[model samples]
Target: MYSSPEQGGLLLSSLCLLSSLLLNTPLCYGGKILVYPVEGSHWVNMKVLIEELYDRGHNITVVRTSTSPYIAEKSPMYTSITIQNDIVFHDFFDSFIEMQIKAQREGASALTFLKLTKDFLSMIGEAHYLSCKVVSQMLDDKEQVKRLQEAEYDLLLTDPAITVGLVLARYLNLPVVLNVRWIASGEGHFAIAPSPLSYIPVSGSGFTDKMTFIQRIQNMLFKSIIMFQQNFVVGPIYEAMCTKYFKDGCDIISLLQEADIWLMRSDFVFDFPRPTMPNVVYIGGFQCKPAQPLPADLEEFVQGAGEHGVVIMSLGTLVNKLPADMTDQIASVFAKLPQKVIWRHLGKPPSTLGNNTLLVNWMPQKDLLGHPQTRAFVAHGGTNGIQEAIYHGTPVLGIPLFFDQYDNLLRLQERGAAKILELAKVNGPSFEQALNQVLTQTSYRENIQRLSSLHRDQPIKPMDSALFWLEYVIRHRGASHLRTSANRMPWYSYHSVDVFLLLLAAGGSVLLTTGLLIRFFWRTCQNSKNKIKKH
Candidate 1:
C-alpha cells in the first residue's frame, strides 16, 4: 500500500527521534529491573519502591504471587504481574480469593494454603526444570520466553520468600539484590547477617548467653543437616529434574553465590557492631514514612488522657493468638497502670475490669506512635514496629513472643530506646513497674528521641538512597563490585581456624615421620654392631 507523503514524513521523524534518544541519553527502556515480593506487607514496601523507580524515568516491573484487600484499596501507581498474568490489581485479588476459598474448603488452614502456594516457586538453580515446565504447560508462549530472553534487565531485586528471582537472574545473567525485610532464619546458611544481632537465635537464648555442650553439638548437627539438604538432597534432586525436563544445567547455590548485593533493612543506630560484607548495605528505614491522621474518636480519647496518655499494645501480625492466661495477665497489668492502654486485642480478653483501657481489633500503629499524646508502646518487637516507633521518637516496652522478637527487643534495650520483658515474667507488678519506669524515666525517651533525630537528619531520605543504588545497578550493568569475598572463598577458607588447624596437622605429621625414621636408623646400626661382635 502506498502511504501519503505526510504519513511517510511522520514515520521518518519518529524513527529519527528514537535514534536520538538512544544515542544521546542514559535513560533507556532496556535497563529494566524485576522485583519479587514475599507476600502482603512486603508487597506494600515493594509498591513504594517501584513507584520511586518509575518516577525516576525507568521502566519497572513487579512480579507478585497474591494480592490482598489492603493492597487493592491502595492507589494503583505502578504496573505489576500476578498469577492471572494481568496488571489489574482488583481482578488479581478477586481471582486469589476464589482460589483460596476453594483450597481452604479442601482441609487447608490459611497458613498451610499460603505455604502450599509459595512452594510452586521454582528453585532458581533448576532453570532447566522450570523452563521445561513452562514449555510443557504452554508450548507456544511467545511472550513469556521473549520476556525471559530479551536481555532487558540489568539487575533483579527480590525478597527471600520468593527466592525464584535468584534463578531468573542466573538465567538472564543479571545482578541480584536482596531486600531483607525480616532477619535471615537460622536455617539458611546462604545469607550473610550484616548485624551482630542478626546472628542471634530468633526464639532461644540471647546473644550474650554461652552455648552448652549439647547446644554446640546441636548446632553442628543443624549445619550438617542444612549442607545435606541443600547440596545433596534438594539441590541435586532439583538439578536432575531440571536436566531431565529442560536439559539445562542448574545449580542453586552457585546462582545464589552470584548475587552482587544484599541490602538489609537495618541501620547502625538500631543494629550495633554488626558484621557486614563489603557489598552489604544497611538500607533499613528505607521508604519509611510517617502515618497519616488517626480516627477522630481515637485521637480525642488519647488527648483526654492528658499527662497520662494512652500506651499502645500490639502483638504484631503472626502472634495474635494470645492464650487466655496471657490475655488475663495483660488485662490485669493494664488495669493497674495509671496510663490508658489501647490494646490491639485480636480475640476476646480473659477479663475486662479496666475503665482506663480500651481494646480494639486493629489500630494505626504509625499514627499512634506519632501522636503527641502517645507515651510508650508495649509491643512484640517486629522490625516494622521498632522502625516506626524509633522513627517517631516514641519509647517502647517490648514483650517479645517468638522468632527474632527477643533479639529485636534486645537491640532496642541496648540503644536505651526500649525495655524487654520476658513473656513468662510479664505479670501485673512487673508490667506496671516497667511501664512506670519508661513513662517516668527521662533516659529512655531522651535516648530514643536523640536517635530519632539522628535518623531524621540523615543526608538523604532512606528511600532515595535505595532508589539511587537500585537505579545505579540498572545503569551500570549491575553492582558486581559490591559482591563480597565470601562469595568467592571455599567453605574451609571461610573459617580461618580451619586453615590454622590444617597447618598444625601437617606439621605434626612431618615431625612424627621424622621421629620414626630416626628410630629405624638407630635400631639398624645396633643390629650391625651386634653382628660384628659375634664374628
Candidate 2:
C-alpha cells in the first residue's frame, strides 16, 4: 500500500488523531469504581446506571446489603462486596415499615405536623445510626478494609442518603460522586447543593414554588424545623461515626463538602427553579427507556382495553402491601371504571377484585405507562414512579404516603399533570372521581406530554450525560473545579446574611448615636438659656 504524498500525510494525521484520543481520553474507561447504594429503590434505581458503566468498560464493585441484595447478572468487570447483616437491616426496615403502616392506619389527618416531624426525625436518626453501625461492622474486618485499600478504586459512587458511603469515601481517601435519588432535601443542602428554603420547599413541606405569602411563611418555618431536626437527631450519629472511624478532628460536613460530583435523579422539568453547582448533574430519566414489549399476560390484558384504556395502580415497593380496607376501597373504585386496572398488590388480594382489574405482585410499570392504552397512573408519588410517568407522558393520580412523596405530588399537581388523592380522604367515590377526571381531561394528558417533550429535549440522553461526568471526574482526578464556593461557606455566610446584619447593625448604631447627641445638645442649650434668664 504505497501512497502518494497527500495520502501519506492524511494517513499520518489519522494515526496521530487516534493516538491523541487514546492518550487524552479519561483514565476511568477501565478503572475500578466502587458503588454503595442505599437499600430499596435506591439500589433498584442504581442498577441500570451501574450496568451501563460496566458496559462502557469500567470495573464496578458494589457494596450490597441483604435487604438490597444484588440480583443483576455479573460479569468479570462487575463484582460486589456483599455485607451480610440481614438480621439488623431487616429488623430496622421492618420496624420503620410497621411505624408507617401504623401511622397510616391512624388516619393521615390524625397525625399532626409536630408528630410527623418527630416521627420523621426519629426515623432519620435510627436509619443513620443503623447505617453507621453497618459501616463500622464492615470496617471492623481489618482484612476487608485492607483489601479495599489495596484495590485502589478510582472513584467512590454512593447514595448520599447513606452516611456510610460518605464515611467509606473518607476512609478510602477517594474522590466521591453522590447519587441522590430524590430532589434535594434539607440534608442535600448540607451535603450536595444549596437549596434556599425561602423558595425551595423542604422535602415534606407540601408547598409549591408558586406559594402564597402564608405558604412561604410556612415553608420557612418548616425549613427551620428540618434544620433543627437534622442537627438534633442526625448530626450526633454522623459525628460519632466520624469520630470513631475517621481520624481525629475530622469534620463530617467538611468531609462531605469534598464530594467531587452529585448525580441527582431529578430534572428541572419536574422540579422548582433552584440553584445548583456545576458538579451537581441532573440525570433524571436515566432509567427511562422507550416502551419495551410487555410480557404475554400483561400484553393481553392491556391490549384487551380497546377504547377506555388502562390505569396502573401502584403504591411502589414500599407500600405494595397495603391495608385490607384501603385495598378494598381501591378495588371498589376499579370495579366501576370501564378501563382495565393493573394494581401492584403484594398482600392479601382485595376481595372486591373487579372483573376488569388485574391484581399482580408486580407490574412492568414503565412499559405500562408508555403503552398507548395507558390512561393514567395511581402511584405513591415515588421519585422513580413519577419520573417514569413523566417520561411516558402519563398523568398521575398521586396517593402520596410520606417523605418527599407529598412534595413531589404537589409539584405534579401544580404542573397540571396530576391530581392528589389524600390518603385520609381516599374512598371509593373520591378515587373514582379522581380517576375519571384524569382520564376524561385532555389537559392532563396535554400538560404531561408537554413536560415530557421538555424533559427529552436535551442534547444527549441523560444516561450519557451522567456517564460523561462520571468519566470526566476520573479523567481529571476529580471535578473539584466544578464545585461551588458555597459548599465551603457556613450556611449563614453562604447566604451572606451575616454581612447584611453587620451592615444593618452599623447603620442602626450611627442613627442612634446621632439622635442621642442631638437630644443632649438641645437639653444643654435649654438649661443654659434658663440660667441666663435667671441671672
Candidate 3:
C-alpha cells in the first residue's frame, strides 16, 4: 500500500518477465494415438495407460479384432476400428489350460511336458498367424490404408506379444511405443536387451540369476526353446507377411527392438537385476492405486472375519477353473481355515464347498488386495496380479498354472515374499498347509512390505514416468537418439564376432611372418659356416 514509484516499476517489470516466460513455454495440444493392444490380462494393464493418456487430453483409437475377448468394441476410453479375424484369446487358452490340467492330473511325464510345450507353441503360432492376417487384410484394403495414412498418428501404442502390431506400426510409418513384456518369440528383454545367460535366467529355465555349472548348461538348453519359437514357429509367419507387404522384408525381433520407447511391464524389484536399455521405461505397477471403498456386502463379509481377516484368490483371466478334484480339494481346505475365503471360481460349485467360503464369478482384485482386513492372496502368478500384490504388500500363496506364471512366482519365492504350490502338489493338506504358511508366517508379510517400500520409493510415479516418456517420443517425433543402432546391425556385428575374427587374423599373420624370418636367417648362417669350412 505504501510502495514507492521505483518499487512499483520493478514489480511491473517482474510481472512482464513472468508472463513472457509462460508464453514462451508452449503448451501441448494433445496428440492422436493409435493403440493396438493384446487382449485378456495384457489388456488390463494397457488400458490403464490408455486411460491416463485420455485424461492427459490425448485422442485414442484402438485396433480390435471382431473376435477379441477382453478388448470391447465400444468404450469411452477409445474409438475402436474392428477387423474380422479368427479366435485369438479365450478358446485357444481355455483348451490349452484344459490339456495341461488333464495331463498333470494323470501325472505329468517327460513326454507330457514336451507335448505341453508343443501345444503351447502351436497356440502362439496360430495367434500370430491370425493377427498377421488381420493386419494383412487391413493393408489389402487400399481405402483403409489411405485413411490410416491420413490420420497422421503421433505414435503407435502396442504390445509386441502380438507381432502384427509391430508389422502394422512399420507399414504405417509410425513411431511405436511398446507396452511389452512378452513378444511372440519369448520374453521381451531377450529381444531388445543384453540378457547374458550366465547371470540372467531364461524364461522357463527354473534357475535363478545365481547358477551352478550344470544349471548354466541347463539354462542354455532352455534358451533354445525361445530360439525354436522365433526361428521355426512364429518367425516364418511374420517374415512371409513382411516380405509381401514391404519390399525389404523385416523380422519381428528387429522391428520390436527398433521401437521409439518400451513401457516395460516390470521393474528390478519384481525382476532379476539384468541389463536394460535407455528406452525401457519401468511401469511395473502403474495400474495399481490405493484401495477404494469396498461394496457394502463385500465389506460386511470381510468384516465378519474380525481379527482373523480374509484371504482372496483368483486364477486370473486365462484359465476359467482348475480340475474339479483340485477345486474340491481347495474348497475343503478353505473350510478348515479360520479366516474367511473369497475365491473367483467359474466351475461348478464344489461338492465339498463350506459355508465359510464365498465363490464369485469376478472380484475387485486390486481393491481386495489393498484392504486392511485382507491377509494373504492366492493367485495364479500373472504379471499384473503379482505386481498389484507387490504394490499392496500382499504376500502370495502362488498356484502357478502355465506360461510365465512359474517364473513370476519364482522371483517372489526367492525374495521370501511367496510360496509356490504346483498343480501337481495341490492336495487338501498341501493347499491348507501352503495357505496357513503364508497367512501365519510373519516373514512373508515383512518381506513383501519391505519390497513395497522399495517399489514406492521412486522419484516419480510410474504412470507419470510412462506418460512423460511417451509424450517425449511425441515431442521429438521418435526416440531414435535414445535407441541403439545395434537393432540394425547384423548378427555377426551385433555380437562382435566380426571384430573377434579380425583381431585373430591379424595376430595369426604376424606370428607366421616372424617364423619365416627366423628360418631364413638360420639357413643363411649355416651356408656361411659351410663356406668357411671349405676355405
Which candidate comes out best when scored by TM-score?
3
The superposed Cα distance between candidate 2 and the true structure at residue 363, in angstroms, equals 1.7
In model 1, pairs of residues that clash are: 129-242, 196-274
Error of 3 at 429 (Å): 0.9
Taking all chains together, the TM-score of candidate 3 against the true structure is 0.95
lDDT minimum window of 10 residues, candidate 1: 119-128
Question: How close to the true structure is residue 429 of candidate 1, measured as C-alpha lDDT?
Answer: 79
Q: What local distance difference test score does each model get?
A: 0.65, 0.80, 0.90
Best by lDDT: 3
C-alpha RMSD for every candidate: 11.7, 4.4, 2.5
- List runs of model 1 lying over 4 Å from the truth: 1-31, 66-75, 84-143, 147-151, 181-205, 209-252, 290-292, 349-353, 425-430, 453-457, 493-535
User: Cα deviation of 402 in candidate 1 (Å)?
Assistant: 2.4
List TM-score per model, in order: 0.69, 0.87, 0.95
Superior by TM-score: candidate 1 or candidate 2: 2
Q: How many steric clashes between backbone atoms does each model show?
A: 2, 0, 0
Instruction: Give one digit per residue, the lDDT tens place, for model 3 in 56-122.
Output: 9999999998988788899997899999876556887789888887877778788987998999899
lDDT of 2 by residue, 1-60 (tens): 746889988999999999999998655557789988776787778878887898888889
